[model samples]
Every structure is written in C-alpha cells, then in structure tokens.
Target: MPTRALCWFRRDLRLDDHAPLSQALINHDEIHCVFVFDTTILDALPRQDRRVEFIWHAVAELKETLRQQGSDLIVEHGDPATLIPRLAHRLGAHAVYCAEDYEPAARQRDTRVAETLKQAGIAFHALKDQVIFAKDEILTAAGRPYTVFTPYKNAWLARLHPRDYATWESKTLVSRLARHDDTLVMPSLDQLGFGDTDLCTLRLPLGTSGAETLLKDFLERMDDYAQTRDFPGIKGVSYLSPHLRFGTLSIRRLVKHALEHGGDGASTWLSELIWREFYQQLLWHFPHAATTSFKPEYRDLAFENDTARFEAWREGATGYPIVDAAMRQLKRSGWMHNRLRMIVASFLVKDLLIDWRWGERHFAELLLDFDLAANNGGWQWAASTGCDAQPYFRIFNPVTQSERFDPEGHFIRRYVPELATLDKRAIHAPWKAKVLPAGFTLGRDYPFPIVDHAAQREKALALFGKREG
Candidate 1:
C-alpha cells in the first residue's frame, strides 16, 4: 500500500514555495492536491464578487499546472471541514497537509477538520507559510504578545534569521505527486453560484505567474518606495498586495528582496510586512478585538451611526474631494491607495461619525486584497479603537490631507473627474472654490459638503471623550 497524502490548498494558493505541500512531497510516496471553494464563506458574499472571480482564475491555473505535472487538483465546492476528510478517505490518504490560517473563523474550521481527521485515524499537519513569524513566534521576552507595534517589530527584526525566509522547495519533487488517470473538471463561476465580476478588467494580475510579473515590476521602483509611497498620484507603491493576499507570492520571496536591497525604501516596505504579522498575532491573542474595540472603554463610543452619510460615503458623493476620490477609486478599481485608505477611514468614522466596523465591513466587501487582520487593524487604527491606535483627538482634516498628499489633485481628478478643471488649491475642496468651471454647479453637478468637518470633529471628540474609561 502506498503512503498517500492529501495536500489541501487554501489561502496558500500556489504550488511553488509551498511549505506543507513541499513537506508532504518530501515525506509521502504519493501526494494529491485539493482546493475547496468553501461554500460556507462564498454563500455570504455578493453574487458578482471580484474575489470569487479572482480565486476562480487562480484555481484554474493551479489545476492546469498540476495537470501539466501529470498530477491533478481536486477542486470542490462545499465546506472544507467535511470535504477534506471525505476526500482523504476516498483517496485512501494517510494524512492531510496545509498552511496554517490565523483568522479566528479559519482556526475554528481547521479545528473541526483536525478532529474529524483524527477520528478517521488520519494525520493532519498545518505548517506556517504565509508570514515570517506566526502567533507566539515573535513574542516579547516577558512571554506575552506585544500589543505595541514598534517593540513588536523590533523583537521580530531582532529574532529574524535568514532561514526564516528561505523558500520551501517542492518543484524538484513533482514526481512524488499522485498520478491519476481520472479526468478532473473545474466548475465555472456560475456553476458555483457566483456571477463573473469585472476582475479581468482591472490591472490586478492573478496566480503565481502574475505575482512574478508584479514583483519584477516593483523591484525597479523599490529604492524610491520611501519617497513616493504616500503619494496617490504616481506609481509609487508595489501593487502586489492582491497576490500576497491570495498567497500567489510567498512572503519569504518578498522579504528576501527587501533585505538584499538594503535601503530606507526597502526597510520601510519590510516594516509594513512586519506590521501584517503584528496584526495577525494580535488577532490570535485577542479575537474579541475583531467584533469590538480593543480598548474596552471605546467599545461603546457614542457614534452617530448616521446611515445617510455612510451611504453618501459609499457612493463617493460626500462632497469631500479626497474622501470621495478614495471611495470612488475603491468602487471602480476594487483597490485603494494605502494613504487614501487611512484618509477615507478617518473621514468615515470621525467626519461622518459612523462606526469603524461600518467602514471595515465595507472595505471587506470591496477590497480585492482584503485580509481580515489588516483591514480590521487598519480600521481600528484610523478610528483609535485598537492596540497602538492613533490618539482619539487626532482627526484628519480631509482638505488638508488632500492638499498635502495629493497636492496636484492628480489622484482626486482621476476618480472624481468633476473636480478635474479646478486648480490644485481649490480641487481639494470644490465647495469652497471661489469660482466654478462653466456648466458645473455645486450640489447639482457635484454635491455640497455632506457634513462640516470642523463641526463634526468636535462631535467626534465629544463622542470619544465621553466614553466611560
């Protein structure tokens, strides 16, 4: 009897540099790859979800890659916890292997899968692949998770070894993959109860090949990342986020590039990567933070929770140029600039006095690169409700933020074309413009300011200040 194993692909989508899959290939005589669409999650998403389409494209490529290797990927639509064990038994596999997922929901799913696998006398292995350091791997000397980022980052950097980022080799062992004669058919998006989204129309690339293309492009501009990353107008930042999100690109490959380059730009980029791990660890240690404020006092902050303003914010008709541009960019592209993410989040929570969860949930629905940890961490940081968050009093003045970061209004004009003719000075706040472009009328062509920032800032301050600490 052959020592067979099932290599379950989830967040870690690609075959190359895959840790658990590589480990399985190294140890087992025959390895079968599988990916479950996980209807439990998909059923909750919108019909025309970009993420579903993106995953569909990636999965198709993955299946083809395995087929080219004389192997096959069993793509199924159902709960992975149930599907995995059934497939393991059907394939007569001795074990199942996959990368560890840190999100609370994923942890629960994996736990159930592990219990079922154990009942069937099969081994289950979850290896770390996504991050350089996972939960409790980079903790402080006191044996506690560091909530503060700088110290946590320093600890992470201090503990780092070259071995940590080394690529896991599996391609050389492709012959170990289980060769099956059965014809494998991948299901269409419609068949899976999902409509095709405009994911192809966007610039975002899919799968490992696409990730490689993006990385090659980003490497050229990496040296200037520190100087240019904040500006929304120019091609400053690496757009490899979606690839990173789907595990099309290995975090190790990216970290290696950042370290080998050795500059402020690379260092800054690396810190951002570390921040990702920080949030992951935080989420693991404090799952409650996912649904409520990390700081208990601010959990019940008196937010106005104005639905009308939120709707306006969502539609990008808020009459604040930068905020509107960022929101519209997200609506149209399914991606938003990092700086703009902060600005709009602040505007949504502080300026509009809505709950941070509102903006976080909205981002989760729209963002192609949305990760639970990053999105939640970012929203809480903007709203001053999470660990190491910005001070509650520090509200972003949208007009000034626009003037400073998008001084030329290049980004604003790209999405909010109504303000294209306005001068750089006036483009940041078209409602306050002394003169309007011919045929354009405030509140008619463009909306008047939905809520006064100055007035709302005080309300926001009062909202947070009045919280019973």
Candidate 2:
C-alpha cells in the first residue's frame, strides 16, 4: 500500500526550501498540500486586516504554483485543530507535516492539532524552517539559553555550518505531489470574513515571486545597508520583511546570501537575522515575556496609560514631530522604518509614560510583518523591561533622534505633511521654532508635545527606580 501525507502550511507559506514539505515528499509516496485560513485567529482581527489580505494573495500564488505541478493546494477556512484531522482522515493520509511555529499560542494550537492527529492515527511532524537557529540551538557554555544577544549571536555564528544553511530541495520531488481530480477553488476574501484592504495600494510584492523581486533589488544596495539602514528616507533596507514573516522567502536562503556576500553591510544584516533567532529562542524558553516584563524586577513598574494621550499618540498628534511621523506612517501604511519604530516605542514608554504592552498591541494590529517574538522583544527593549533592554535612564530624545537619523526631515514630511512647510531645523521640533510658518499655528496645526520629555524622563526613572528598590 502506498503511503500518503498531508503538508500543512502555516507561517511557512512558500514551497521552496521548506522542511516538512520536502521531508514529506521524500518519506511519503503521495503528498497533499494544505493552508487553513484559521477562523479562530481571523475572528479576533479587524475585518479589514492587511495580514489576512496578504496571506490570501500569498496563498493564491502558492495554489497557482502547486497547480502548475501535478498537485493542488487544499485551502480551507476554519479552525485547524478540528479541520486538520478531518482533512487527513478524508484524504486517507497516514501523516501530517508542517513548519514549527514558536509563538506561545501557536505552540498550544499545534499541540492540540498534534493530539487530534494522533487520535486519528496520523503522525504529526513539525520541522524547523523559520529561523537559522531556534530553541537552545545557540546556548551558553553552561548549556543555558543566552539572555543577552551578543553571546547568543557569537554562539550562533560559531556553530553554523554550510549544511545548516543549505537549501532543502523540495521541487525535485514535485513528482510525489498527489494529483486529485477535485477542483481546488480558493474561498473569496468575503467568504473568509475579511474585507479587502489597502494591501494592493501599498504595492508590497506578494508571495515567492515578490520575495525574489525584493531580494534582487536589496542585493544591489546591501553593501550600504549598515550605513543607510537608519535613514527612513533611503532605500537601504530590504522590504522583504513581509515575505520573511509569511515564509515566502526561506531564512536559510537569506542567511546563505549574507554569508557568501561578506561585508560590513552583509554582516550587519546577518546579525539582524541572528537577532531574529535570538528573540525566537528567548520566547520559547521564557514564554512569560510575551505578556509581561522579561525582567521580574521591572514587572510592577507603574504606568500612567492615559487613554486620551494614547489616542493622540496613535493618531500621530503627539506634538513630537518625529514620533508623530512614525505613528502616522504606521497608521497610513502597515509598516514603519525600524529606526522610527525604536524612537516611537521609546517615546510611548518613557516620554508618555504608557505601558509598552499598549504600543505592542497597536503594532500587533497594524504591522504587516508583526511577529510575536520580534514585536514583543522590541517593545520590552524600548520599555527597558526585557532581558537585553536599554538602560531605564537612557530615554530617547525624539528631536535628537529625528535630527540624527532623518536630518533632512524627508521622512517626517512624507508622513506628517502638516509640518512639511517647516524648515529642517524646525521640522524636527516645530513647537520650538523661533517663528512658525505664516499660517501654521503650533497647537492648531499640529499637537503641542503631549508631555514634557524632561519631566516625564524623571518620572519614568522614579517609576523604575521605585520598583527596582
């Protein structure tokens, strides 16, 4: 009797360089590909979610690619824990395979699915694919997970072999993809309970082909990434993050490219990739960090969390041009430049004295490439509550950051156009301008700084200091 397997696609959306998909194709005589819309997750999200739309397009592309081969993708919209077992049983599959997801909730969901699959007598296989190294793969000499990133990154680099980054050849075994006479029609966005979003207007390249387009373009500028990445106005960074989040591009392929093309830029870029794995492993080992401070001592620090102030910050009327611009950019587009992300996050936690979780949740709702590990890690870092966070006293001066990173105010003007007429000097801190633009009244046109940074810095310090004491 011929063996049959079901390859479940989750975060790992692409077919190439896939671990479980390739492994299934090798071990099983026949394979069926699947992607569930996962209503349990979707029902909680806003009706017009960009991530859902992005996934839809990516899934459609994956389906087309699979259709080109002898196989077809089984796209279903429902709870996977209930659906996977039924699908496997109906298809007469002996096993199910999928890429490993490290987020706490996802791990729980996978556990449930695995138990259900086992009850149905279907073997469950979850393979590593999202990161170069994950879950204690890079640990200290004492065999403990590294809390700090530098040592973790060093260990990660030292342990890396060419085999670790080698491409998993799944396409070669495409012949094993099971051909079914049933027509594979994808559900419409409406059918999936998601409305159309501005994803198309954002012009983000979708799916595998899109990832390739961005990778090619980024390679041409990768040499300058280190120097220019901080500037939001420049095209220094690869816009391949969405693809990375969705696994349209393989982590190994990126790591391999960075390793082969050695330079300060590539090394810096590679370190970022390493940081991603570091966060992934951190979350796996310390799941509590997802909801609370990574450092126990910082957990009880008091935050104002003023709802009106938070609304102003969210609407990009914080009266701090740089911070406002960053928030507005996130509001208008589903993404923000990384430098701006840090600046805004610091402003939210330190200047406004709000909970980092508030900003984290907002970003979770908005970011096109929001990964739980990265977003939570970043928020904690900015809030000075994570394992390797910034010192609590070292609050970011939004004006200073803007002048340093976006000197010309090109990024600010792009998003916060109300300040466009202000000269570069005033653009960063328009309220402090010697003379406002003829028609631009400070409070009327743009918000006054919601809180005094100096006073708030002292308050933030006291808040943390009291807790630490």
Q: lDDT tens digits, residues 277-384, model 2?
A: 988999999999999999999887779889999999999988998898899889888999999899999999998899999999999999999999999999999999
Point out the worst 10-residue segment of candidate 2 by lDDT.
132-141
Those runs of model 1 whose alpha carbons end farther than 4 Å from true positions after fitting are none
Q: Cα miss at 213, model 2 (Å)?
A: 0.6
Clashing pairs in 1: none
Per-model TM values vs. the true structure: 0.98, 0.99
lDDT per residue (tens digit) for residues 1-469 in model 1: 6699999999888988899999999989999999999999999998999988988888998999999999989999999989999999998999999999999999999999999999999999999999999988877788999999999999999989999999988888899998889888889999999887888888677888898989999999999999999999999999989889999989999999999998999999999999999999999999998999999999777788889999999999999999999999999989999999999999998999999999999999999999999999999999999999999999999999999999999999999998788889889988787988888888888899999999999988888888733
- Global lDDT of each model? 0.92, 0.92
* Global Cα RMSD, each model: 1.0, 0.9
